[model samples]
Target chain A: MKARVHITLKNGVLDPQGRAIANALHSLGFDKVGDVRQGKFIEIDLKESDKAKAKSEVDQMCAKLLANTVIENYSVDLVE
Target chain B: MKSAIVVFPGSNREKDAEAALTEITGTPPVMVWHRDTELPKVDLVLVPGGFSYGDYLRCGAIAAHSPILREVKARADQGMAVLGICNGFQIITEAGLLPGVLQQNAGLKFVCRNVNLRVETSQSLFTSRYEKGQVLSIPVAHHEGNYYADEKTLDELESRDQVAFRYCAPDGSLDPSHNPNGSQRAIAGVFNRTKNVLGLMPHPENAIRELLGSTDGRGLFKAMAEALAA
Candidate 1:
Protein backbone atom coordinates (compact mmCIF):
# COMPACT_ATOMS: atom_id res chain seq x y z
CA MET A 1 0.00 0.00 0.00
CA LYS A 2 1.02 3.60 -0.53
CA ALA A 3 0.20 6.71 1.42
CA ARG A 4 0.27 10.31 0.30
CA VAL A 5 0.60 13.16 2.75
CA HIS A 6 -0.11 16.81 2.17
CA ILE A 7 1.15 19.27 4.72
CA THR A 8 0.58 22.99 4.98
CA LEU A 9 1.24 25.82 7.37
CA LYS A 10 -1.61 26.25 9.83
CA ASN A 11 -3.91 29.17 9.24
CA GLY A 12 -2.71 32.63 10.33
CA VAL A 13 0.96 31.63 10.24
CA LEU A 14 3.04 33.78 7.92
CA ASP A 15 4.03 32.13 4.63
CA PRO A 16 7.16 33.77 3.31
CA GLN A 17 7.42 31.40 0.40
CA GLY A 18 3.84 32.09 -0.58
CA ARG A 19 4.42 35.81 -0.32
CA ALA A 20 7.54 35.55 -2.44
CA ILE A 21 5.66 33.63 -5.07
CA ALA A 22 2.98 36.26 -5.12
CA ASN A 23 5.54 39.02 -5.42
CA ALA A 24 7.21 37.18 -8.27
CA LEU A 25 3.93 36.66 -10.05
CA HIS A 26 3.13 40.33 -9.78
CA SER A 27 6.57 41.23 -11.03
CA LEU A 28 5.96 38.99 -14.01
CA GLY A 29 2.79 41.05 -14.74
CA PHE A 30 0.32 38.49 -13.34
CA ASP A 31 -1.05 41.05 -10.92
CA LYS A 32 -3.98 38.99 -9.70
CA VAL A 33 -2.52 36.35 -7.38
CA GLY A 34 -5.61 35.81 -5.26
CA ASP A 35 -3.76 33.67 -2.75
CA VAL A 36 -0.79 31.39 -2.43
CA ARG A 37 0.66 29.36 0.39
CA GLN A 38 3.43 26.87 -0.16
CA GLY A 39 3.13 23.41 1.30
CA LYS A 40 4.84 20.00 1.24
CA PHE A 41 3.62 16.77 -0.33
CA ILE A 42 5.12 13.43 0.63
CA GLU A 43 4.53 9.93 -0.74
CA ILE A 44 5.43 6.84 1.22
CA ASP A 45 5.25 3.20 0.23
CA LEU A 46 4.62 0.87 3.09
CA LYS A 47 4.27 -2.90 3.26
CA GLU A 48 1.00 -2.89 5.16
CA SER A 49 -2.15 -3.62 3.17
CA ASP A 50 -4.75 -2.35 5.65
CA LYS A 51 -5.95 1.08 4.62
CA ALA A 52 -7.13 2.02 8.07
CA LYS A 53 -3.90 0.95 9.67
CA ALA A 54 -1.96 2.73 6.98
CA LYS A 55 -3.91 5.89 7.72
CA SER A 56 -3.43 5.61 11.45
CA GLU A 57 0.27 4.87 11.09
CA VAL A 58 0.73 7.63 8.53
CA ASP A 59 -1.14 10.11 10.70
CA GLN A 60 1.10 9.16 13.55
CA MET A 61 4.03 9.81 11.28
CA CYS A 62 2.64 13.23 10.58
CA ALA A 63 2.22 14.00 14.25
CA LYS A 64 5.54 12.49 15.23
CA LEU A 65 7.91 13.23 12.36
CA LEU A 66 6.42 14.19 9.02
CA ALA A 67 4.65 17.45 9.86
CA ASN A 68 5.40 20.24 12.30
CA THR A 69 2.04 20.45 14.05
CA VAL A 70 2.75 23.79 15.71
CA ILE A 71 2.69 25.65 12.42
CA GLU A 72 1.53 23.06 9.96
CA ASN A 73 -1.45 20.76 9.36
CA TYR A 74 -1.35 17.48 7.50
CA SER A 75 -3.83 15.22 5.67
CA VAL A 76 -3.21 11.64 4.63
CA ASP A 77 -4.52 9.70 1.66
CA LEU A 78 -4.21 5.98 1.08
CA VAL A 79 -3.48 4.65 -2.37
CA GLU A 80 -3.72 0.99 -3.07
CA MET B 1 22.98 24.02 38.47
CA LYS B 2 23.04 20.89 36.32
CA SER B 3 22.22 21.33 32.66
CA ALA B 4 21.68 19.14 29.62
CA ILE B 5 22.11 19.81 25.93
CA VAL B 6 20.09 17.80 23.45
CA VAL B 7 22.26 16.31 20.74
CA PHE B 8 20.28 15.25 17.73
CA PRO B 9 22.03 13.23 15.06
CA GLY B 10 22.79 16.24 12.85
CA SER B 11 23.18 18.94 15.50
CA ASN B 12 26.56 20.65 15.16
CA ARG B 13 26.13 23.43 17.69
CA GLU B 14 25.83 21.22 20.77
CA LYS B 15 29.52 21.55 21.51
CA ASP B 16 29.37 25.31 21.22
CA ALA B 17 26.62 25.39 23.80
CA GLU B 18 28.59 23.07 26.07
CA ALA B 19 31.62 25.26 25.78
CA ALA B 20 29.66 28.36 26.62
CA LEU B 21 28.06 26.77 29.65
CA THR B 22 31.35 25.39 30.89
CA GLU B 23 33.09 28.68 30.37
CA ILE B 24 30.62 30.63 32.45
CA THR B 25 29.10 28.12 34.86
CA GLY B 26 32.24 25.97 35.31
CA THR B 27 30.20 22.84 34.69
CA PRO B 28 30.06 20.81 31.54
CA PRO B 29 26.61 19.99 30.17
CA VAL B 30 25.51 16.41 29.70
CA MET B 31 24.93 15.45 26.10
CA VAL B 32 21.45 14.03 25.64
CA TRP B 33 20.97 11.90 22.58
CA HIS B 34 17.70 11.99 20.67
CA ARG B 35 16.95 8.30 21.05
CA ASP B 36 17.37 8.36 24.79
CA THR B 37 14.21 8.82 26.84
CA GLU B 38 15.87 10.58 29.74
CA LEU B 39 17.55 13.91 30.33
CA PRO B 40 20.11 14.45 33.05
CA LYS B 41 18.83 16.15 36.16
CA VAL B 42 19.32 19.83 35.48
CA ASP B 43 17.83 23.22 36.13
CA LEU B 44 18.45 24.38 32.59
CA VAL B 45 18.07 22.63 29.23
CA LEU B 46 19.49 23.72 25.93
CA VAL B 47 18.52 22.74 22.42
CA PRO B 48 21.41 23.87 20.27
CA GLY B 49 21.51 24.76 16.59
CA GLY B 50 22.73 22.85 13.51
CA PHE B 51 21.03 20.65 10.95
CA SER B 52 19.27 18.27 13.29
CA TYR B 53 18.54 15.11 11.32
CA GLY B 54 19.98 17.02 8.38
CA ASP B 55 16.84 19.19 8.46
CA TYR B 56 15.35 16.60 6.07
CA LEU B 57 11.65 17.30 6.47
CA ARG B 58 11.82 20.77 7.97
CA CYS B 59 14.22 22.63 10.22
CA GLY B 60 13.25 20.55 13.24
CA ALA B 61 10.56 18.07 12.19
CA ILE B 62 12.48 14.85 12.79
CA ALA B 63 14.22 15.74 16.03
CA ALA B 64 10.98 16.88 17.64
CA HIS B 65 9.75 13.26 17.75
CA SER B 66 12.87 11.92 19.43
CA PRO B 67 12.30 10.07 22.67
CA ILE B 68 14.23 12.62 24.70
CA LEU B 69 12.01 15.48 23.64
CA ARG B 70 9.11 13.87 25.48
CA GLU B 71 11.10 14.27 28.66
CA VAL B 72 12.27 17.72 27.66
CA LYS B 73 8.70 18.79 27.25
CA ALA B 74 7.84 17.35 30.63
CA ARG B 75 10.67 19.21 32.31
CA ALA B 76 9.76 22.43 30.53
CA ASP B 77 6.19 22.13 31.75
CA GLN B 78 7.55 21.82 35.28
CA GLY B 79 9.20 25.27 35.02
CA MET B 80 12.68 24.23 34.01
CA ALA B 81 14.28 27.01 32.02
CA VAL B 82 14.54 25.90 28.40
CA LEU B 83 16.43 27.74 25.69
CA GLY B 84 16.33 26.87 22.01
CA ILE B 85 18.82 28.43 19.63
CA CYS B 86 18.64 28.42 15.81
CA ASN B 87 17.49 25.00 14.70
CA GLY B 88 16.82 24.54 18.37
CA PHE B 89 14.21 27.24 17.98
CA GLN B 90 12.73 25.25 15.14
CA ILE B 91 12.54 22.14 17.28
CA ILE B 92 10.80 24.00 20.09
CA THR B 93 8.21 25.30 17.66
CA GLU B 94 7.84 21.84 16.16
CA ALA B 95 7.26 20.48 19.65
CA GLY B 96 4.61 23.13 20.25
CA LEU B 97 6.55 24.62 23.13
CA LEU B 98 6.62 28.04 21.48
CA PRO B 99 4.45 30.05 19.13
CA GLY B 100 4.14 30.43 15.39
CA VAL B 101 6.89 28.91 13.17
CA LEU B 102 10.24 29.57 11.59
CA GLN B 103 9.76 29.79 7.87
CA GLN B 104 12.18 29.92 4.97
CA ASN B 105 14.07 33.18 4.48
CA ALA B 106 12.17 35.62 2.36
CA GLY B 107 14.95 35.63 -0.21
CA LEU B 108 14.96 31.82 -0.37
CA LYS B 109 18.63 31.73 0.56
CA PHE B 110 20.48 30.45 3.58
CA VAL B 111 21.64 33.47 5.59
CA CYS B 112 24.87 33.39 7.58
CA ARG B 113 26.14 36.68 8.96
CA ASN B 114 26.58 38.81 12.01
CA VAL B 115 23.36 40.63 12.91
CA ASN B 116 22.63 43.20 15.53
CA LEU B 117 19.77 42.21 17.83
CA ARG B 118 18.32 44.81 20.15
CA VAL B 119 17.24 43.55 23.49
CA GLU B 120 13.53 44.17 23.70
CA THR B 121 12.97 42.99 27.25
CA SER B 122 15.41 42.03 29.97
CA GLN B 123 12.93 40.68 32.49
CA SER B 124 13.33 37.04 31.51
CA LEU B 125 16.12 34.74 32.67
CA PHE B 126 17.67 34.84 29.21
CA THR B 127 18.14 38.58 28.82
CA SER B 128 18.44 40.05 32.29
CA ARG B 129 21.85 41.63 31.71
CA TYR B 130 21.05 43.73 28.70
CA GLU B 131 19.20 46.98 29.07
CA LYS B 132 15.77 47.02 27.57
CA GLY B 133 15.85 47.95 23.90
CA GLN B 134 19.64 47.98 23.82
CA VAL B 135 21.07 46.70 20.57
CA LEU B 136 23.86 44.17 20.56
CA SER B 137 25.53 42.46 17.65
CA ILE B 138 25.30 38.67 17.49
CA PRO B 139 25.71 36.14 14.72
CA VAL B 140 22.75 34.48 12.99
CA ALA B 141 23.07 31.58 10.59
CA HIS B 142 19.98 29.82 9.37
CA HIS B 143 17.69 29.16 6.41
CA GLU B 144 14.36 29.20 8.18
CA GLY B 145 14.52 31.81 10.94
CA ASN B 146 11.86 33.93 9.37
CA TYR B 147 9.42 34.43 12.28
CA TYR B 148 5.71 34.53 11.47
CA ALA B 149 2.48 35.08 13.39
CA ASP B 150 -1.01 36.32 12.50
CA GLU B 151 -2.21 39.85 13.17
CA LYS B 152 -4.04 38.99 16.34
CA THR B 153 -1.13 37.01 17.74
CA LEU B 154 1.30 39.70 16.73
CA ASP B 155 -0.77 42.28 18.53
CA GLU B 156 -0.87 40.12 21.62
CA LEU B 157 2.88 39.67 21.57
CA GLU B 158 3.28 43.41 21.18
CA SER B 159 0.76 44.28 23.85
CA ARG B 160 2.40 41.94 26.31
CA ASP B 161 5.92 42.96 25.20
CA GLN B 162 6.81 39.31 24.69
CA VAL B 163 9.16 40.11 21.83
CA ALA B 164 12.70 39.60 23.13
CA PHE B 165 15.08 40.59 20.36
CA ARG B 166 14.67 42.20 16.99
CA TYR B 167 16.92 42.67 13.96
CA CYS B 168 18.67 46.01 14.10
CA ALA B 169 21.12 48.04 12.12
CA PRO B 170 24.27 49.62 13.57
CA ASP B 171 22.45 52.86 14.34
CA GLY B 172 20.45 51.02 17.02
CA SER B 173 17.02 51.24 15.40
CA LEU B 174 15.03 48.61 13.53
CA ASP B 175 15.95 48.52 9.88
CA PRO B 176 14.79 46.36 7.03
CA SER B 177 18.28 46.30 5.49
CA HIS B 178 19.51 44.22 8.42
CA ASN B 179 16.55 41.87 8.16
CA PRO B 180 18.39 38.76 7.03
CA ASN B 181 15.31 36.54 6.73
CA GLY B 182 12.51 39.03 6.18
CA SER B 183 10.87 37.88 9.37
CA GLN B 184 7.50 39.36 10.23
CA ARG B 185 8.20 42.53 12.19
CA ALA B 186 11.91 41.59 12.07
CA ILE B 187 11.63 39.34 15.12
CA ALA B 188 14.78 37.57 16.17
CA GLY B 189 13.84 36.06 19.52
CA VAL B 190 10.74 35.43 21.61
CA PHE B 191 9.73 33.92 24.91
CA ASN B 192 7.04 31.35 25.59
CA ARG B 193 3.56 32.20 26.84
CA THR B 194 4.86 31.96 30.39
CA LYS B 195 8.07 33.82 29.52
CA ASN B 196 10.19 31.07 31.05
CA VAL B 197 11.39 29.56 27.80
CA LEU B 198 13.16 31.35 24.96
CA GLY B 199 13.73 30.50 21.31
CA LEU B 200 15.86 32.50 18.94
CA MET B 201 17.51 32.14 15.56
CA PRO B 202 20.83 33.81 16.37
CA HIS B 203 23.57 31.92 18.26
CA PRO B 204 24.59 33.87 21.37
CA GLU B 205 27.09 31.20 22.37
CA ASN B 206 29.04 32.04 19.26
CA ALA B 207 29.49 35.64 20.31
CA ILE B 208 30.42 35.35 24.00
CA ARG B 209 34.17 35.54 23.51
CA GLU B 210 35.86 38.69 22.30
CA LEU B 211 38.24 36.60 20.25
CA LEU B 212 35.21 35.55 18.22
CA GLY B 213 34.77 39.24 17.29
CA SER B 214 32.25 40.33 19.95
CA THR B 215 31.78 39.90 23.66
CA ASP B 216 28.21 41.12 23.50
CA GLY B 217 26.87 37.60 23.75
CA ARG B 218 28.65 36.90 27.03
CA GLY B 219 26.33 39.11 29.03
CA LEU B 220 23.32 37.08 27.99
CA PHE B 221 24.73 33.80 29.32
CA LYS B 222 26.16 35.58 32.32
CA ALA B 223 22.78 37.07 33.06
CA MET B 224 21.17 33.66 32.90
CA ALA B 225 23.86 32.25 35.15
CA GLU B 226 23.27 34.93 37.75
CA ALA B 227 19.55 34.36 37.55
CA LEU B 228 20.17 30.67 38.01
CA ALA B 229 22.39 31.36 41.00
CA ALA B 230 19.84 33.64 42.57
Candidate 2:
Protein backbone atom coordinates (compact mmCIF):
# COMPACT_ATOMS: atom_id res chain seq x y z
CA MET A 1 0.00 0.00 0.00
CA LYS A 2 0.95 3.60 -0.45
CA ALA A 3 -0.24 6.85 1.08
CA ARG A 4 -0.09 10.52 0.19
CA VAL A 5 -0.25 13.29 2.73
CA HIS A 6 -1.27 16.81 1.82
CA ILE A 7 -0.21 19.25 4.51
CA THR A 8 -1.11 22.90 4.33
CA LEU A 9 -1.08 25.90 6.61
CA LYS A 10 -4.51 26.60 8.04
CA ASN A 11 -6.39 29.62 6.74
CA GLY A 12 -5.82 32.94 8.61
CA VAL A 13 -2.27 31.88 9.46
CA LEU A 14 0.42 33.87 7.69
CA ASP A 15 2.36 31.77 5.16
CA PRO A 16 5.74 33.35 4.51
CA GLN A 17 6.85 30.64 2.12
CA GLY A 18 3.67 31.06 0.13
CA ARG A 19 4.15 34.78 0.02
CA ALA A 20 7.73 34.37 -1.23
CA ILE A 21 6.53 31.98 -3.91
CA ALA A 22 3.84 34.41 -4.97
CA ASN A 23 6.40 37.18 -5.22
CA ALA A 24 8.66 35.03 -7.36
CA LEU A 25 5.75 34.05 -9.61
CA HIS A 26 4.77 37.68 -10.06
CA SER A 27 8.33 38.60 -10.95
CA LEU A 28 8.41 35.70 -13.41
CA GLY A 29 5.61 37.39 -15.42
CA PHE A 30 2.77 35.25 -14.11
CA ASP A 31 0.64 38.09 -12.83
CA LYS A 32 -2.57 36.11 -12.95
CA VAL A 33 -1.75 34.72 -9.53
CA GLY A 34 -3.87 36.48 -6.95
CA ASP A 35 -2.60 34.34 -4.06
CA VAL A 36 -0.32 31.36 -3.66
CA ARG A 37 -0.05 29.01 -0.72
CA GLN A 38 2.71 26.43 -0.84
CA GLY A 39 2.20 23.13 0.90
CA LYS A 40 3.86 19.76 1.29
CA PHE A 41 2.90 16.73 -0.77
CA ILE A 42 4.40 13.60 0.79
CA GLU A 43 4.13 10.07 -0.54
CA ILE A 44 4.98 7.10 1.59
CA ASP A 45 5.18 3.37 0.84
CA LEU A 46 3.69 1.21 3.52
CA LYS A 47 3.67 -2.51 4.21
CA GLU A 48 0.16 -2.42 5.62
CA SER A 49 -2.42 -3.87 3.24
CA ASP A 50 -5.56 -2.60 4.95
CA LYS A 51 -6.62 0.66 3.31
CA ALA A 52 -8.74 1.68 6.27
CA LYS A 53 -5.94 1.01 8.70
CA ALA A 54 -3.44 2.79 6.46
CA LYS A 55 -5.55 5.94 6.37
CA SER A 56 -5.85 6.05 10.12
CA GLU A 57 -2.16 5.31 10.61
CA VAL A 58 -1.16 7.97 8.13
CA ASP A 59 -3.46 10.45 9.84
CA GLN A 60 -1.77 9.70 13.11
CA MET A 61 1.61 10.12 11.48
CA CYS A 62 0.62 13.49 10.11
CA ALA A 63 -0.74 14.62 13.42
CA LYS A 64 2.29 13.44 15.34
CA LEU A 65 5.16 14.47 13.06
CA LEU A 66 4.11 15.58 9.60
CA ALA A 67 2.08 18.69 10.45
CA ASN A 68 1.69 21.17 13.26
CA THR A 69 -2.01 21.35 14.10
CA VAL A 70 -1.60 24.82 15.56
CA ILE A 71 -0.66 26.33 12.20
CA GLU A 72 -1.23 23.60 9.60
CA ASN A 73 -3.71 20.86 8.74
CA TYR A 74 -3.08 17.51 7.09
CA SER A 75 -5.08 14.87 5.25
CA VAL A 76 -4.10 11.45 4.03
CA ASP A 77 -5.12 9.30 1.07
CA LEU A 78 -4.28 5.60 0.85
CA VAL A 79 -4.02 3.45 -2.27
CA GLU A 80 -3.57 -0.23 -2.69
CA MET B 1 24.53 22.58 40.86
CA LYS B 2 24.09 19.75 38.38
CA SER B 3 22.61 20.67 34.99
CA ALA B 4 22.18 18.64 31.85
CA ILE B 5 22.12 19.99 28.30
CA VAL B 6 20.17 17.88 25.83
CA VAL B 7 21.99 17.25 22.57
CA PHE B 8 20.41 16.05 19.34
CA PRO B 9 22.50 15.14 16.34
CA GLY B 10 22.06 18.53 14.69
CA SER B 11 22.14 20.64 17.84
CA ASN B 12 25.11 22.92 17.25
CA ARG B 13 24.40 25.17 20.18
CA GLU B 14 24.68 22.48 22.82
CA LYS B 15 28.30 23.30 23.51
CA ASP B 16 27.60 26.98 23.77
CA ALA B 17 24.87 26.32 26.30
CA GLU B 18 27.15 23.99 28.22
CA ALA B 19 29.94 26.54 28.18
CA ALA B 20 27.65 29.18 29.55
CA LEU B 21 26.62 26.88 32.35
CA THR B 22 30.19 25.80 33.14
CA GLU B 23 31.32 29.40 33.17
CA ILE B 24 28.71 30.24 35.77
CA THR B 25 28.56 27.07 37.88
CA GLY B 26 32.30 26.33 37.69
CA THR B 27 31.44 22.79 36.56
CA PRO B 28 30.59 21.36 33.18
CA PRO B 29 27.05 20.16 32.50
CA VAL B 30 26.12 16.67 31.46
CA MET B 31 25.41 16.47 27.70
CA VAL B 32 22.46 14.14 27.32
CA TRP B 33 21.97 12.56 23.94
CA HIS B 34 18.55 12.56 22.31
CA ARG B 35 18.35 8.76 22.27
CA ASP B 36 18.61 8.45 26.01
CA THR B 37 15.43 7.43 27.74
CA GLU B 38 16.43 8.56 31.23
CA LEU B 39 17.65 11.91 32.42
CA PRO B 40 20.14 11.96 35.24
CA LYS B 41 18.94 14.04 38.17
CA VAL B 42 19.88 17.60 37.43
CA ASP B 43 18.92 21.05 38.63
CA LEU B 44 18.32 22.47 35.16
CA VAL B 45 17.78 21.31 31.60
CA LEU B 46 18.78 23.42 28.63
CA VAL B 47 17.41 22.55 25.20
CA PRO B 48 19.71 24.58 23.02
CA GLY B 49 19.40 25.63 19.37
CA GLY B 50 20.21 24.25 15.92
CA PHE B 51 18.30 22.47 13.14
CA SER B 52 17.38 19.35 15.05
CA TYR B 53 16.70 16.35 12.82
CA GLY B 54 17.32 18.75 9.93
CA ASP B 55 14.17 20.68 10.86
CA TYR B 56 12.28 17.98 9.01
CA LEU B 57 8.61 18.59 8.37
CA ARG B 58 8.73 21.57 10.75
CA CYS B 59 11.26 23.22 12.93
CA GLY B 60 11.54 21.54 16.35
CA ALA B 61 8.73 19.14 15.48
CA ILE B 62 10.96 16.09 15.06
CA ALA B 63 13.15 16.78 18.05
CA ALA B 64 10.11 17.24 20.25
CA HIS B 65 9.35 13.53 19.91
CA SER B 66 12.87 12.45 20.73
CA PRO B 67 13.09 9.96 23.56
CA ILE B 68 14.78 12.19 26.13
CA LEU B 69 12.01 14.77 25.87
CA ARG B 70 9.68 12.31 27.54
CA GLU B 71 11.80 12.57 30.64
CA VAL B 72 12.18 16.31 30.25
CA LYS B 73 8.41 16.65 30.10
CA ALA B 74 7.92 14.50 33.18
CA ARG B 75 10.42 16.50 35.19
CA ALA B 76 9.11 19.79 33.91
CA ASP B 77 5.63 18.76 35.02
CA GLN B 78 7.09 18.27 38.52
CA GLY B 79 8.24 21.94 38.54
CA MET B 80 11.73 21.42 37.20
CA ALA B 81 13.39 24.36 35.48
CA VAL B 82 13.55 24.07 31.68
CA LEU B 83 14.86 26.58 29.18
CA GLY B 84 14.19 26.22 25.47
CA ILE B 85 16.18 28.62 23.29
CA CYS B 86 15.59 29.22 19.56
CA ASN B 87 14.91 25.84 17.93
CA GLY B 88 14.41 24.59 21.45
CA PHE B 89 11.39 26.91 21.69
CA GLN B 90 9.94 25.14 18.68
CA ILE B 91 10.40 21.84 20.49
CA ILE B 92 8.68 23.14 23.60
CA THR B 93 5.64 24.19 21.58
CA GLU B 94 5.55 20.93 19.62
CA ALA B 95 5.82 19.05 22.90
CA GLY B 96 2.74 20.84 24.26
CA LEU B 97 4.65 22.23 27.24
CA LEU B 98 3.78 25.77 26.20
CA PRO B 99 0.97 27.58 24.47
CA GLY B 100 0.86 29.01 20.95
CA VAL B 101 2.99 28.13 17.94
CA LEU B 102 6.07 29.56 16.28
CA GLN B 103 5.70 30.03 12.55
CA GLN B 104 7.90 31.31 9.77
CA ASN B 105 9.11 34.87 10.02
CA ALA B 106 6.41 37.12 8.58
CA GLY B 107 9.13 38.69 6.43
CA LEU B 108 9.89 35.20 5.03
CA LYS B 109 13.52 35.72 5.87
CA PHE B 110 16.00 34.14 8.30
CA VAL B 111 16.66 37.06 10.64
CA CYS B 112 20.10 37.40 12.24
CA ARG B 113 20.57 40.60 14.18
CA ASN B 114 20.78 42.07 17.65
CA VAL B 115 17.28 42.92 18.84
CA ASN B 116 16.14 44.92 21.84
CA LEU B 117 13.97 42.84 24.20
CA ARG B 118 11.88 44.09 27.09
CA VAL B 119 11.65 42.13 30.27
CA GLU B 120 7.93 42.13 30.75
CA THR B 121 8.10 40.20 34.03
CA SER B 122 11.15 39.55 36.20
CA GLN B 123 9.41 37.26 38.62
CA SER B 124 10.41 34.00 36.98
CA LEU B 125 13.40 31.81 37.82
CA PHE B 126 14.64 32.51 34.31
CA THR B 127 14.34 36.30 34.34
CA SER B 128 14.49 37.91 37.79
CA ARG B 129 16.93 40.72 37.16
CA TYR B 130 15.20 43.25 34.98
CA GLU B 131 12.42 45.43 36.23
CA LYS B 132 9.12 45.28 34.46
CA GLY B 133 9.42 47.10 31.12
CA GLN B 134 13.21 47.15 31.36
CA VAL B 135 14.82 46.78 27.93
CA LEU B 136 17.77 44.52 27.19
CA SER B 137 19.65 44.19 23.94
CA ILE B 138 19.75 40.57 22.82
CA PRO B 139 20.34 38.87 19.48
CA VAL B 140 17.63 36.95 17.67
CA ALA B 141 18.50 34.44 14.91
CA HIS B 142 15.67 32.36 13.66
CA HIS B 143 13.35 31.65 10.71
CA GLU B 144 10.23 30.28 12.41
CA GLY B 145 9.79 32.65 15.34
CA ASN B 146 6.52 34.37 14.49
CA TYR B 147 4.46 33.49 17.56
CA TYR B 148 0.74 32.85 17.07
CA ALA B 149 -2.17 32.02 19.35
CA ASP B 150 -5.94 32.51 19.46
CA GLU B 151 -7.33 35.70 20.91
CA LYS B 152 -8.71 33.98 24.00
CA THR B 153 -5.38 32.33 24.72
CA LEU B 154 -3.59 35.62 24.17
CA ASP B 155 -5.93 37.26 26.63
CA GLU B 156 -5.37 34.47 29.11
CA LEU B 157 -1.60 34.75 28.76
CA GLU B 158 -1.74 38.50 29.19
CA SER B 159 -4.04 38.35 32.18
CA ARG B 160 -1.81 35.76 33.86
CA ASP B 161 1.44 37.70 33.44
CA GLN B 162 2.71 34.81 31.34
CA VAL B 163 3.76 37.24 28.63
CA ALA B 164 7.35 37.43 29.85
CA PHE B 165 9.23 39.28 27.14
CA ARG B 166 8.48 41.65 24.27
CA TYR B 167 10.64 43.05 21.52
CA CYS B 168 11.18 46.77 21.81
CA ALA B 169 12.82 49.56 19.82
CA PRO B 170 16.08 51.25 20.92
CA ASP B 171 14.10 53.86 22.79
CA GLY B 172 12.54 51.06 24.92
CA SER B 173 8.97 51.12 23.61
CA LEU B 174 7.08 48.58 21.50
CA ASP B 175 7.41 49.18 17.78
CA PRO B 176 6.89 47.07 14.67
CA SER B 177 9.75 48.80 12.90
CA HIS B 178 12.16 46.15 14.28
CA ASN B 179 9.79 43.30 15.06
CA PRO B 180 12.11 40.90 13.24
CA ASN B 181 9.74 37.96 12.92
CA GLY B 182 6.38 39.72 13.12
CA SER B 183 5.53 37.82 16.28
CA GLN B 184 2.05 38.52 17.55
CA ARG B 185 1.91 41.61 19.78
CA ALA B 186 5.68 41.88 19.44
CA ILE B 187 6.12 38.86 21.73
CA ALA B 188 9.66 37.55 21.87
CA GLY B 189 9.48 35.16 24.81
CA VAL B 190 6.81 33.64 27.01
CA PHE B 191 6.35 31.38 30.04
CA ASN B 192 4.03 28.56 30.94
CA ARG B 193 1.29 28.85 33.55
CA THR B 194 3.63 27.93 36.42
CA LYS B 195 6.41 30.02 34.89
CA ASN B 196 9.06 27.32 35.54
CA VAL B 197 9.26 26.47 31.83
CA LEU B 198 10.28 29.24 29.44
CA GLY B 199 10.27 29.24 25.67
CA LEU B 200 11.73 32.20 23.88
CA MET B 201 12.45 32.86 20.20
CA PRO B 202 15.58 34.91 20.82
CA HIS B 203 18.89 33.22 21.77
CA PRO B 204 19.87 34.44 25.24
CA GLU B 205 22.84 32.08 25.21
CA ASN B 206 24.29 34.08 22.34
CA ALA B 207 24.12 37.25 24.39
CA ILE B 208 25.70 35.97 27.64
CA ARG B 209 29.33 36.73 26.85
CA GLU B 210 30.98 40.14 26.82
CA LEU B 211 32.56 39.74 23.38
CA LEU B 212 29.03 39.29 22.01
CA GLY B 213 28.69 43.03 22.78
CA SER B 214 26.27 42.56 25.68
CA THR B 215 26.11 40.68 28.96
CA ASP B 216 22.42 41.26 29.41
CA GLY B 217 21.76 37.52 29.17
CA ARG B 218 23.86 36.57 32.19
CA GLY B 219 21.11 37.57 34.57
CA LEU B 220 18.92 34.81 33.22
CA PHE B 221 21.49 32.17 34.19
CA LYS B 222 22.46 33.86 37.41
CA ALA B 223 18.84 34.07 38.37
CA MET B 224 18.38 30.37 37.72
CA ALA B 225 21.44 29.52 39.79
CA GLU B 226 20.15 31.61 42.65
CA ALA B 227 16.72 30.04 42.42
CA LEU B 228 18.18 26.55 42.51
CA ALA B 229 20.55 27.39 45.37
CA ALA B 230 17.73 28.81 47.43
Q: In lDDT terms, which candidate is top? A: 2
**Model 2 per-residue lDDT tens digits across residues B1-230:** 77899999889888888878888766688999999999998888999999999998788888899999989999999999899999999898899999999988998889998999999898888888678888888888888999999788889999999998998888788889978998999998889999989999887777787887888888888888888873
First chain TM-score, candidate 2: 0.93
TM-score, candidate 2, chain B alone: 0.97
Colliding pairs, model 1: none
CAPRI band for model 1: medium
Report how far off residue B186 is in candidate 1 (Å).
0.9
| Interface Cα RMSD of candidate 1 | 2.2
lDDT of 1: 0.87
When only the first chain is scored, the TM-scores of the models are 0.94, 0.93
Each model's C-alpha lDDT? Answer: 0.87, 0.88
lDDT for each residue of candidate 1 in B84-198, tens digit (9 for 90 to 100): 9999999988888887788889788998889999899988888988999788989999989899877788788878878999998887788899899988899998888788789
True contacts kept of 1: 0.79
| TM-scores, each model vs. reference | 0.88, 0.96
